[model samples]
Target: MSKTNAARILDRLKLPYEILEYAVDPDDLAAESTAEKLGLPPEQVFKTLVARGDRHGVCLAVIPGSAQLDLKALAVLAGDRKTDTVPLKDVQPLTGYVRGGVTALGTKKAYPVYVDELMLTFETVAVSAGKRGLMLWLAPQAYLTATQGIVGAIARSSPP
Candidate 1:
């Protein structure tokens, strides 16, 4: 497969990563499913979310596939009083990535990136390759450095 903008950015940074592709199930775009398809546990896969802070405008929140973004926690980290996920209709225009394909590496703009501290526990984490059906696997620290990500407790366990 041709390289994606995310991969290109990694190359420019001289970071090593592996691209893995799976069959895309349009009906099941959940990160959990993506992890399953890749034979990985959900927490090993990170999903990027777009959130708008009342003061900071837009930022990226990356959390484990099995967790959910904690808006309040994110707001604290972004230094905003309030934050909410951007509307679905605004996601593509804002980040140049569709729902299932969003990644913090190479967005349309360099929005501040907030990554859940959980990712640091793993040697490598999987994130979208700027498109659906494709995933990028790299050392968490390398990915964080590439995106200039801020680490924080910005995610919470999904409700049972």
Candidate 2:
């Protein structure tokens, strides 16, 4: 398969990573499904979210697929009083990546990235490869370096 922008960046940086591809179910864009496909735990798979802060124009937040972003807490971390996810229609235009395939590592816009502190619990985490059906797996530190990500308690367990 051809390299995605994210893969290219990782290669250029000489950061080791594994690329995993699975069948895409357009109807099911959830990250958890992808994790299952890769034989990884849901918590090890992260999904990227784009949010607009009252003060910051836009930024990317990544959290475990099984959890949901804590917008109020993220606002505090972002130094903004409030923050909301960007509209679905605008996600592609804003980040050059459609839903189910957004990665902050190599986006159209270089927005600041914040990864959930929980990610550090694992030796490696998996994120989108900037394409549907593909995932990038690498050490958390390497991911932080590649995406310039800040680690914090940005997510909490989502209700079942």
Candidate 3:
């Protein structure tokens, strides 16, 4: 299998991780859908979101499929008046990855990264391996360390 941006970052950081690949329909894959396809719990899978902070250039948020990013919390963490998610068009050039394939690591620029504190509860967490149909399972701390991510309670329950 080809190494993804996430895998490349992990390898560069010398962190141990396992890559998992499965069939995925790029047009229809969602975090929840990917989790189901891989036979993994939704909470174990995370999605990477790029947000624009009022003063903080660009920031990355990592949250479980079962949770939602708390914009207010992120604003506070970023010390900004507010924060807004970057649109799909802007994300690719900024992060050098498509919406469903963005990884916290290997972005075009080194933006501040935040990972939901809840992820620490799991021994291993899965994140996009920089492409559709691929994921990586590794210690959450390893991910944080590799990305220089800040841990915070920046996630909220998903809407019904």
Candidate 4:
């Protein structure tokens, strides 16, 4: 598989990461499904979400696959009075990645990134490799270092 922009950034930073590829299920692009395919707990797989703050414009939220982005919490972290997830159609143009492939690394623009505090509890986490069907596995600290992400309680359990 050809290296993605995200991977190239990691390479330049001299960070060690492993790229894992899986089949893409167009009908099921949920990060939870990707975790299941990789035989990992959903909590270990992080999903990147694009959100726009009323004041800050756009930022990326990295939360566990099984959790939902807490917009209010994110707003607090981003110092915005309000925040909302960007429309699906705007994701690619804003981040240069499709819906199932958004990552903080190598975005078309460098947006502030906020990662859920839960990620620190895990030794490693998996995030999109800037495209669907591929995941990058690296230590939580390594991921943070690469993205310079802020750590906060920006996630909540998904409603049943």
Extract clashing residue pairs from model 2.
Answer: none
| Candidate 3 structure quality by residue, lDDT tens digits, 85-159 | 988899999998887788888898999998999889999999988887889999998998998989888999888
- Which model is ahead, 1 or 3, in terms of TM-score? 1
Clash-forming residue pairs, model 1: none
Q: Give the distance in Å from residue 110's predicted Cα in candidate 3 to where it truly belongs.
A: 0.6
Tell me the tens digit of each residue's lDDT in model 1 across 75-123. 9999999999999999999999999999998888899999999999999
Model with the higher TM-score, candidate 1 or 2: 1
Give candidate 1's whole-model lDDT.
0.96
lDDT, model 3: 0.89
How do all models score by TM-score? Answer: 0.99, 0.98, 0.96, 0.98
TM-score of 2: 0.98
TM-score of 4: 0.98
lDDT of 4 by residue, 1-160 (tens): 9999999999999999999999999999999999999999998999999999999899999999999999999999999999999999999999999989999999999999999999999988999999899999999998999999999999999988
Whichever of 3 and 4 has more TM-score, that candidate is: 4
Whole-model lDDT values for every prediction: 0.96, 0.93, 0.89, 0.96
Report the error of model 3 at residue 32, Å: 0.6
RMSD each, Å: 0.5, 0.7, 1.0, 0.6
Error of 1 at 139 (Å): 0.3
* Candidate 3: residue pairs that collide: none
Lowest-sum lDDT 10-residue window in model 2: 105-114
